[model samples]
Target: MTIHLSKSRLKYLSRLGLFLFLLILSGLFYASCNTQSSRNQSGKAHLGESPMTDSMVVDQLIQRSRSFYEETGMRAEPFDRFLQEAMEIASRHNLLWQQVRILNTIGRRYRDRSAYGEALRYHNRALTIAQNINNKGLLSEVYNQIGVVFRRTDDNAIALDMHFKALRLAEETRDSFNISVAINSIGNVNANLGRYHSAIEYFLRALEYADRLDNTLGKAINNHNIGECRLKMGYPEEALEYFQKSLAYNNQIGSRAGQSICYNSIGAVYIAKDDPVTALEYLERALNINDRLGDLMQVSISHSKIGEVYLLLGDFAKADDHLNKSYELAKNIGSRFQAEESLRLLSRLHEANHNYATSLEYFKTATAYRDSILNEKNINHLTTMEAMLETEAQRNRIYQLNQMTSEQLITLGRQRLMLTIIIIIFVILAVITTLLIYQHRLRIKYNNLKNQHKLLRSQMNPHFIFNALSAIQVYVLEHDVEKSTKFLTDFAKLMRLVLKTSHHDFIPLKDESEILKYYLELQKLRFVSPFNYQITIDEGLDQENTFVPPMLTQPFVENAVEHGVRLMENQGHLDIRFKKLNTQMVVEVEDNGIGISSSIDQKQKSGINKKHESMAIKITKERLDVIRNDIGGKVSLEIIDKKNINPFDRGTLIRIILPIVSQNN
Candidate 1:
């Protein structure tokens, strides 16, 4: 039916209808967004200098980056401009040391981007440059850089070897920077190996350099690292002190990234202290910064942390909401570490609520991720080597093929074009098949490794740092020149290790043992021979062939003296022993101190007065998982409570079992 209406009435009806439609559409869009504010979208507190709209865009970019990772994997267009720039810098600079330095920088860029293949290429090129220059100093630096590549690729053994080389180089140069760098690197390697005492000594030494050089950044990093290591070794109060020092430097620098990390770390400490509100604030802060930075990696972690806090707060829906976000982000970012960690938090949360089936499902997911990451890390190493070899062989073949006369090649090209097509088809098909299989494996592996790393990188907590300077200050004030000299020398050596090894995975056993022995001697001087301690190893254990996780057993020994043995009224006694087993080594740290209780482990978990591991034990466990899974070996940990389990045993019994491989292997 058609009806003619007055022009004024028709226009009025049209305007009213349009207005109604607009209102309804706006309501629907608002509902879809859950009414999120521009600032809240990034989940950050509206702190100074943070704009709402800017935060929203950052959140959007973060989402986009995750989507990008999911769609394109880690295959970002290799910043060819940057690589070329570095190459040009290397070439134009006649100094081989400068070339090595540039190459190392390029390698680090690739490493940060998770492009191990490209990183390896640059690192190897740097190594060649160092060799050509015959600069032991550059060689040492290259070794350390190569170790970084190994750690990234999950070869802790090789990583340690390179770190050792760097440490030796540092010693040769007598340069405090390299010495500190090398020492710190070694201690970190030992810490990763579960030698917390060694890690502590190394960090203390690093503090010395940082102080000597007046390097606030280095000091803060080392202190933070030490606190992180101590948290694993079960020293909450000490860890917090270290973290505080770390924060001071980070604050002074006004580094948003460092601030975010410190906030999250502080939150972990608060959580350990049993404060959820503060934890949430810090986690949210970290999440906000990570979102703005388009760092899904850190965001996923913050999400999981928030989920954990919510779960503790008994908010099921809230917990699930954040956990789901975490999982989705982890999956989207192709970070198996985060996904697995999210699954774990979900598992624990559900299990606590008596949701066994759901818990099992989540647990299964976590396990799968764990396994997948391990495999991927392992294959990353092998595939990297394979890719390089294949590229080289192909290049050589291409060069040889190119050498033929132009006419001969043209005739050959025409004649063999058809036959070549068949062969090419077959080769292409085989390659595609292999790649498909490889990709499937790679996907599973990458996700798995991501989950493992997610848990380890959780913010610092209940941190600790051992300050040699304070002790030295005390000695100097007391006019104890002999003690001061000895302490200073040990301090210098330890600092050298920390500066060198902060970035490594594992270090040579000989080097680690040397540092540990030195640390023990220094501590003995501080204690004025309160008790004598012996570090005994079986035949062949000292060889570079036998390697352990960084900083595994040293802490328990230190704890015996610091908390247990030294507290005693009588003379203290400690026993540190190491024995190699078939493909494994058993390390025991026993002492005469106040006995351990059955509830100690549980107390440790709750972050009560008991020793706190922060994420140290978990990190070492994860790093070991990385090592064992990558190397086709197994690693295990056991802590023996002195009182309940063994009445006769007075102090703590810290046992470490490590996989033993031949030097070549």
Candidate 2:
């Protein structure tokens, strides 16, 4: 077992217990390597007959797995079973954070084996658990692991998204290890995408963090990634320096996986230098270590590189053998990338050997895989563009921060003071502006009230009063004293009601409805051809508690009665409805007589020379506009001609929407 513990994880264990546990793990690994005992037997022997609590068992299992990680390195299969057992125990005990850790570990193992689908499944499970626990540290670790899986699968866009999310969460939680890991992972994606310069920037930033934490593993990883970017940027000598630095760190930490990667990277640098002899030594070293560790992904890559070197040296037989093994291992691990490279090398080797037909077949298959990969790369380009823009912005922000000075601090303070002064000035201007607007609105309201009083005084036109008085006198001369007295009394009541309520801004719906009834009755009395009128209020309305602007609907109702219902040759009908619609009140005055358009044309032909516009209507609309402006409420007047709906139908329908104002109890 190869076990590696993070600095943060190691903080949980006492030095004495960790040392003792390492001693036991070393002996067990030694015995397993020598075939003295089965791996399962060794693990059980260490944990058997212990009366530890569930938490202790989980801790021991986790520590044991960590030891396996160190000893066997990235070849984590030997410890995977123990970790699964730990996961089961932790789940049974509802140890949520333990489950997240175990899931992330297993996911990484799957990632190492190039089982991307299974890796994502485990990581997603970890992500869900971490989110449920609301633990930023666990969430960051899981996001970083998921990002690595996507990067390996050549999904750079998703990889960048995941890595950035991990970086943000790690920064929020001050998880230094994860922050470095996430930044380094982003660099790897950029390097693979051919953005070597951008990749180098990220690598250097990540290195700064790793150095601060003195995290040997983080340092090795960042150094190796920087080497990759440099090598891709065509700086083989510079790349060698970084690779050596990484190798030394890995050696110090005894990281077999990290050492393997450094060896492979160095080999690649030598290959770029056209030094096959030197490259072969490093390539073989990586192959041996990866083969021993059972990391098929790295093993495949190593074989492909070694085979390429052999082909370069004109060693066809050795090249064919290595390339075939590389392809087989890559295919078994589902690594299409490695398989494609191996197939391409094999095609070249066959071509060199004059095997034209076989070479062509290999070339065709490799092309198919390459085409599919290119299609995936096209999708990645969209994310690549976005990542480039974001990375540039991040660089600018970092540069600005790094360039800050004492003088800049003084300038910043001055700017802040200026901003405060500007805000105070703006506030004063806003208050003055508000007062001026209020004064202007008050003047407008005063003029509207004046017009309203004038319209109300005009409501009792001499023509209407004279007509009512003449009707009363006719009833008196006909000796109908009771009818005369009743008509006179009703007319007086209507006049008084309108005068009393006209001065108020708002009156109760009950009082307003009473005024409308009284006016309609007096008008009905004056009509020679009598009309029936109905006024209804919605049952749901609390008429006494709800108030509306006084007489808002009176003009429209008067128009309907006078122009629409009064001119009918047959029996006329007037219907007024006050209904509630949601938060607004709806008032509808519908009359069946001559429609509004017809009445206008009739009056024009009859030489009624006055303009058709009613003063009462004009004043009422101004009042509604004021109401609408002041309260920002819905107040509208819509007149619908029934003749437009059907030519034979004659009537006008008036709808007034008023804001509902109710007194709070």
Candidate 3:
């Protein structure tokens, strides 16, 4: 082993050692390359032009784009640039998941801008990619986003179908977040369809899911939706409670948009309660928030709501200013619904000020806008239906292609026969359902008409006629020719007015006001103690144009005079104020007399039967309910016992809100 060697042999041995070292280095380099190739394949970054090494760079781009989309308030210019860059990176690296995400974000941005067609295209592309990849979670998100686009386009039926599909997929994959989103979307569709109870039910279910998942944003949105449903159903008190809860949650989460919406809802509730003074405070807060957020649509709504409050408060100048601002903003933003609402309010304001020509123009413009909205909805519905039909045809063709063998062909023929039979059965069922619904609607209409007639009979009570005749007879017997002549003339006019209006359901507010004036004057002549009476019509009321149910306010007015004012020890005072608030005619009848409680106490002590008074009020309530059903407007009565407000103020204040019944209807 230690044998001596020549110099040439030693040099050859050293060269052999160096060659072995170089061989080992080359093998290690090949192993590293193989490992990188395997990682690229597993990461799905090997399909495109860019190498796997660029995936990290593309991923960073996607993250930056997502952060921009979430953090920035949809600043379109910057967002568009970022999204385009991200999309290019994802495509270059063939990042399928990132592409899907980027596409969805673009779709949502288009949707927020109300570009429905563009939104649908992007979402559908994302949906196709998700389907190709068999990604259930991504599919659920794409389906939900597509449903929102359909909802915004007014294809509510299709929207609901899409959301249900999303819910099914999300549930199957146990995706809590997407499940909550789908449920909330379904609720919105129901609400848009005017199924308020159904909407609330869906929203409540969504809230439960959100609570389970501890999703603060989901809970906030669900609560807000529930509040909107309650408001639509005329449950203002319940709506207020839900809105407050939503506001709290939004505040905790620092959602400016949610907070703005909650504030607007709370303001609307106050408006409905006829407290315009308080309503303005909340509406202004919403306006400020929306302005800060640069949400033009929301700002328009806030302006409109504030205008409505000002109108209710009899500040026509302020009302006009705000409504005009709302109109301009809505028109600029292409918000047809808000623009139409503003136009309607403007028409009413002009009519109230006796600008008939201008009012007519505005009314016509509002009607045109409304028709356009309806047309848009119809177009969207037809488009969705066509799409559905095309999809069905595609499915049928796929079924045909799948059946190639003789046995399969025979099975296909049998399936065709079965499908024809099923179609016939469905048609029959649909016809039957249609007939049933038609019958139900007719029955409801019949009941409403019958109730309206009953209300009319109650309004023209025989006791009221007898009391008027008795008062006139006393003036005749006194042999006071001047008083007797005036009494007979007024009584004849009253009878004629009643006869004229009794045959119809509604009369102009001006006519109703005249009737009250004559009736009150006659009552003053007959009363033993002198009382002061004043009737004030707000400057913002369209007395000649606005129509209301005949004799709606007379009963309350008669009650105030006979029961309340008559019982007062001192000279009584009666104040009647008429104003228009939103779509309603608000009549406030106040009497500084013995309070209703004291009057009832005296009556009970004297054992006087007051059945007629209760009956009159009951009939009035029923009449209001009928009007509400017939016209789709809210009618309410609030009787405020002044003693509750101030112990020394002894009287009853009756506030009646009558819906402005359309004369054309």
Candidate 4:
């Protein structure tokens, strides 16, 4: 196998062999480089497809990311990578809407992971881009995502504001998906605020919209929210049903995170149902899923649930371990609510274990956290309430100013019209003397009618104001600040409504009903004697779209409350009814109190409330007259003393007929 040679000849052969080997090595390297270049060229060719094919690729990537999101309920590794690739392609192609969409997806992922700062940063960037592109749909979605971030961070006020803003944008664009999302977000905020009824209402509405769109994710979330609301409302059985429904939907979509949430919710319901064994089963399932998904916030919540189940089973050691783990995880994620719950459970566990000192320490910490949370919630509520009150006050002031300005403009317009008419009459006086005379008569009649109308409205203003002030003074004299504050708020609202509609000839029947209800409530508050009232509208009548003269029946109602029911020995009852009868609107105001005749006699003899009685009658007559002339239709008011029909029935009844006016008219 070996060949020997002389030294010189062997050296020459070794040199020659080394040279050949170096040549072969260089050739092999060159071939390998050529093969790699060809492969690179092939890959480049595959990537640089037709424009249509590139667009398809981007769309496919985006769709894949969305599918992954639906499957995982948050961003899985594949989902993130897919979105990244799509983002790169979208950015390079200047596909702005797609870019914004991808950014929103990423923001939601960060939000789901409890990375609020990163979530907000991404959402804000997407918002900027969406606004620059004037993409309302994208803008709405980004706003929604940002709202979720704020909600997760417990900035409920800001979160609610953002959700409302998103709702407005979504509604404007008619983006059904975004609309449902925004509504669901708002429901979550309300739930956090402990407005479970309002939250349920919002969730139901969102669910309806989602059902119409067949959106599985939306359905799953809404169902979960409804379950939480029901659970809070003390309906464990109902809550369990909703939670199971949510789980079904989540399963249908293969949403692991959603399934985890449902498992936790179901566990809560089972605990409420006093089935600790079943609860433990669900809690463990939720914890396993949360741990695998790396959802620290959810993990904390799940552990706390498991701890609660263990505590219910009297397993102190297990409870302590789980609760401590929950507390640590909650602290890591900055979830004060979860941390507080865990601490509270820990305190209970320690107390059960007879560790009095440790129990007290944990109890103190839990109490501190609870108080802090309550303080934040109260501050938020009070701030929102004050702002709303201020806004209403400002609106009233602005409306009053506008009303004054409008009246001045109307007076100026009337003067200009009168001057023009005078000029025209003078110019054609000789040529059309008879016509001018007839026109002059018409003008005089119109002016007299207008004066009567203004006089009737003015009469209502002072009488109502004086009575309201007198009632308010009673509360003030009693030094009842709470009652006085409440009375003042109601008075302000009524005054604002009256002032707003004072100048209008007609307003919606719905608005009139609201005013009547408010006035009745205010009157009831003033009187020591209690009264009951019911307002019924015919189902056939369109209260919102039907129009009638403003405050047409208000004077009669006032008379019933003030004269008939004010000093009644027994509790008085009032019934008001609105009906659509053929071409006319019929209203009935009946009161079970002193007869009108008796009331009139009492007031006349005492000389008290005489002026109010006269003004009421005067305004009623004048209003009827104006309405009859203006509409050129049948209008009548009839007052009946119930004693006249039957002496035992001591009450007053009034019926009125008005020409129907549609909203458009």
Candidate topping TM-score: 3
User: Against the hidden true structure, what lDDT does model 2 obtain?
Assistant: 0.80
Clashing pairs in 3: none
Regions of candidate 2 where Cα sits further than 4 Å from its true position: 1-53, 63-81, 113-115, 294-297, 331-334, 368-665
Better of 1 and 3 by lDDT: 3
> Candidate 1 overall Cα lDDT vs. reference?
0.70
Per-residue lDDT tens digits of candidate 1, residues 9-112? Answer: 33544465556556555665675467456636433321112444543443454345445544553455333343445445334434345456657766776777
Q: How big is the positional error of residue 50 in model 2, measured in Å on the Cα after superposition?
A: 18
Task: Compose the digit string of candidate 2's lDDT tens values, residues 432-451.
Answer: 56555655666665666656
Worst lDDT 10-window in candidate 4: 1-10
TM-score of 3: 0.51
lDDT of each: 0.70, 0.80, 0.79, 0.80
Which tens-of-lDDT digit does each residue in 489-543 have in candidate 4? 8877776777777767778889889888888877777778779999999888888
Model 1, residue 290: C-alpha shift (Å)? 2.1
